[model samples]
Target chain A: MEAQGVDVVVLCGENNVAYATGHAAPSQEPARAGATRTVAILTRTDVRLLTPPPLDFDDGVRELAAAIGDHAGTLAIDEYPSMLVHAALAPHAPVDARPLLTAAKFVKMPAELDAMRRAQRINEQAMDDVLPALRPGIRDTDLSALFFRRIFELGATGNTVDPIWNVLPTSLADGPFTFTGHLPFPLPAVGRVLEKGDVIFNDAGIDFNGWASDFGRTWYVGVDPDARQRSQFRRYLEIVEACRAIIKPGASAWDVAIAAREANGGQPPWFPHLYVAHGIGTDSAELPFCGTDLGAEIESQVIFEPGTVLVLEPVVWDDGHGGYRAEEVIVVTDGGCELLTDYPHAPYE
Target chain B: MSKERVLDEMGRREVDVLILGREGNARAVSGAHRLFLAGERAFSPGCVVVAETGAVHVLSVTDFGVPADAHLYPPSWNPATLVGRVAALPGVRSAKRVGVDGITPLFEALLTAAVPDASLVDGEAIMRAARRIKSPDEVDHLRAAAAVARSTMAVALNGVARGLDDSGVVALAMEAMAAEGTTTAAFEPRISRAGQRVTVAVGVLRDGWEADVTRTAPEVDRPAELVAAIARCHPGVAVADVGADVHGVGCGYEALPADERLEPGMVLSVSVAGAGDTVLVTEDAPEVL
Candidate 1:
């Protein structure tokens, strides 16, 4: 705040509120989520929160204005409610707080890292129960059912996304058409039943007290991998290893992006719309995003600090045959990055 | 028919174009099955509805059951890029008034700069009016969603009877809902245990519509408060007279004002405090689903 010369900072987005206040709320659809937002106000000296039961646009703006009191300094805000803009904030022209937030949240503290580790442990253990139940007759939603039940039982605040257990086609031509022509992935699960040899790309995320755990791996139903599939998995590991080799404190995001592309023969190994590695904290995807549309210019400027975490996901596409995809959660250290994702890459492994 | 209804509302409100930011509004407008990501997001243009051409352009990477005529654009992180796409839509740049469900400072600037002549107005009220009356297909989807909610709800009630903890009961209920092919939940199943009484509520979203059901342990007759609320759900009665907490249960939890009148084809989820079932209001009577 001092660096930006802003006296008051207001946040309305849920993840930003959670990050500011250390409070977690039940996740809902967008409309309900907006209507039931929890607003947080941070001044250099004090912090205040306006939770639900009184959070419509008009009342929220009034409370926010009241909280600001007589401060005449500049205000930074994460979201703009039109009512707020038309009423109290039209004069201030609130500066965007995302850059300030990104800088502050880029490096995780020890306690935040511990929270993430616990969240990942819950996610992985739930998968341990889910993986054994994957078979030919089980539908995609059946896996989702088991996964949801296990996560709540094991203690998750909420499920982050509809658990994706997408059954990928052998060729991109057979998959859903995309404007980018890159293979679309992580589509919502339906009642599609698994076949004996179908390859499944699994991805799920859950919230544990405002911390997010992102899990991704590839699975096969009722069959061992063929030689081509095994080769795909091996190649995926090679790309991951290449990225991991240079993920030390001083390394730039561009260096990791370059290593993954070079390991995959100069082609970006992840989805074009997505990233090679994204930092995850309160939000499932956050700062230090590498290999996204932002490209090399922005990426080279993103330096990895000691406590920065990255989820490295690289897909090894064999085109005619199915491919292998997995993600590793690693935290940068003084020496190198340490793996936070411990789920085994079995069947493929 | 849904699009026609929305267009009619737009004509009534004199909105030249609509830029829907909420996922439910976008889904309601476009009839697209986009990926469901949980939690609140900052407002950005997700779907654009051009009044002049009646074209719905969605921000999607792939056409996941999107209508054939609807255009798809890959998601962008840059606000300028998004504004540019919205500007290029057939009628957006020439529009005199652009209605948006929500906006942020950055998008407001970008959009204003891109379309210099357009005035950004509140489309939320227009959407609420358009969405108040459910179409026949929307009713069917909501009915199916209610059935899906009941499938898991029974398991939850059973768990409450079986001496399970709140987490255990909720876990079983969610699993059952998913097994029925509904992975998205409209609301987290709220289960609270207070001495002898255990209140369990579960809601699910199937095909972008919502249905919510709630029950308590030691199942008894419907509470008088809720019964009175249901009885008052006639075509012209004001919702405030219902004497309970009533909310519209459709694409999402539609938070209507107390004075809003109940109309035929409006589906509502009513609870005194927290024991409610979804009710469909019609000209003759209220049907509980």
Candidate 2:
């Protein structure tokens, strides 16, 4: 921070807090109105954290200003500032430090990489324990229940608060259903029953300790996948493999996307900005995104270095075949990429 | 009461448009209160653009989403693409002044470039003020969620085991909710182990309504002083801060302070660890629902 001429850095996001501070600092969940919100400050010499008084302040803004005092060269996380924090600190012209922070975070510390490896291990083991229990008539929620139970058994405190757990059939994969989301439907993992030939396309995520794991997979239920299912599924898995083969230290983030797009049969996806691959660690979707959606200039500017963990998920969306997206977490290695997640890419239990 | 409060508060703030910004970070997967007001549920980042007159618009980005109505963008809107859509919002595009639920330098820059002349102000107070009141449907959802939470807690803590870790206890509650037939556990089920300060904050969603309740396992019995401090709570009664954990749980988990005066139909989870039963404020007394 001093080298960058940045003075005090205010850490608000949980992951940022965890990155700067060893443990995940408890920040108030921002789901409510007028609840006590916490913010932490990191300076050259000292670190201070502040929270709204527990029902004490009539003018919380005034108190927050006093707490902030007169720090001029301030830097705050753009993604997690509160209204008061923005209003009060805007005048000081705090440096938009997200880019700087993201850059610093891209090259993970050895411990950070180890933490991610730990998180993915628990995530993969949980999937392993629950896959064999799959049947034709099981409800989506039943799968979620067992899958999550296994995660806990393997040592995750809990999954990320809004992790996606969609369990739908291949018939509904295309236009009608979203394969990735926390609450894609009115209810998550309930009432929806799976039948034979259904595809369990999951983009579920979980948090172990403060680190997070995000990956996607598609599994066929009781029957062997038909030709249409096999083709669509193969398209996505092949793209992931193709992208995986190209990733290495010193690869351009944009070239990674363009080459992956070419390997993905040279056509644009139904939607835009859906990266063929993107970096992931604390945040599921971080910088270094590559795909046809990011345009050529942006793709050319993205470069990957050693220690950066990225999720390569090539999606195939056929209106008739529905949709299929399988994600794999790989770390940029000196020679090539190392697969961190050991979950199966094949559509099977 | 549904959206009129938003308009009224915006009117009071003299803001022509109110845009509720995204909550959490890229990895944080929760909706802001704006989504609740707009009657939309999206896990990804989105914004609710509100007019001075309470007209609400939702723009979301999801993998394969089709909102029942045509409200969702056909190509769905991600954060990168949302700025253009937000700039195009009828109320926002026409506004001379705008109020945002929250702000950041990056978002402020986007807003400034989008609406050059519009002055931006904080709309957190206005949004929070409007969120305090619960509609009939909201109350029912809270009740249903509370009932499930109460049962789940009972089952999990019935014979509390020392071997259970944080995730294991949460798994028990998730299984319990599933067995009871509610798919959405409003928030992710949380369980801190016994020695690490056992706490439970469950946000369960039914239909579109959410009920949130948090409780910490009793460590040492709070002496009579702490118990007596809470005995005075009732409907239409002002509450001085007694310092024990107190918060109101409603449409978006918690939207009211614990020390505020209780209103009828308002449900609160109050205790040091959020373990206190939810109390529904009524015309006369605060009923422990």
lDDT at A178 for candidate 2?
A: 39
Which candidate number would show the highest TM-score if scored against the true structure? 1
Interface RMSD score of candidate 2: 7.0
lDDT of model number 2: 0.60
Tens digit of lDDT per residue, candidate 2, span B1-289? Answer: 2456667777777878766643411111122221111111112325454554344554444433223322343122234455667777656667887766556556677777878888876665666666666667667666887788777776555424454655567677766766665544555565665564566666565443455555566543344543543455566566555345566665444545445776676666655433555666667755555
Interface RMSD of each: 1.8, 7.0
Candidate 2 local Cα displacement, residue B199, angstroms: 6.7
lDDT of 1 by residue, B1-289 (tens): 3678788889988899999888888888888888898888878899888889988899988986688878887787667887898898888998888888767777888989999998888777777788888977889999999999887888988888888888888789889988899999997789876778888888899988999987777753477777878888898888778887788977887877767899999999888755888999998989988
TM-score of each: 0.97, 0.85
In order, the first chain's TM-score in every candidate is 0.96, 0.84
- Model 2, position A278, has a per-residue lDDT of 75
lDDT minimum window of 10 residues, candidate 1 chain B: B216-225
Where is model 2 more than 4 Å wrong at Cα?
A: A25-38, A54-64, A72-80, A161-174, A177-190, A269-273, A346-349, B22-45, B52-54, B61-70, B73-81, B159-167, B178-231, B241-244, B255-259, B272-274
Residue B119, model 2: lDDT of: 82
True-structure RMSD, every candidate: 1.7, 5.0
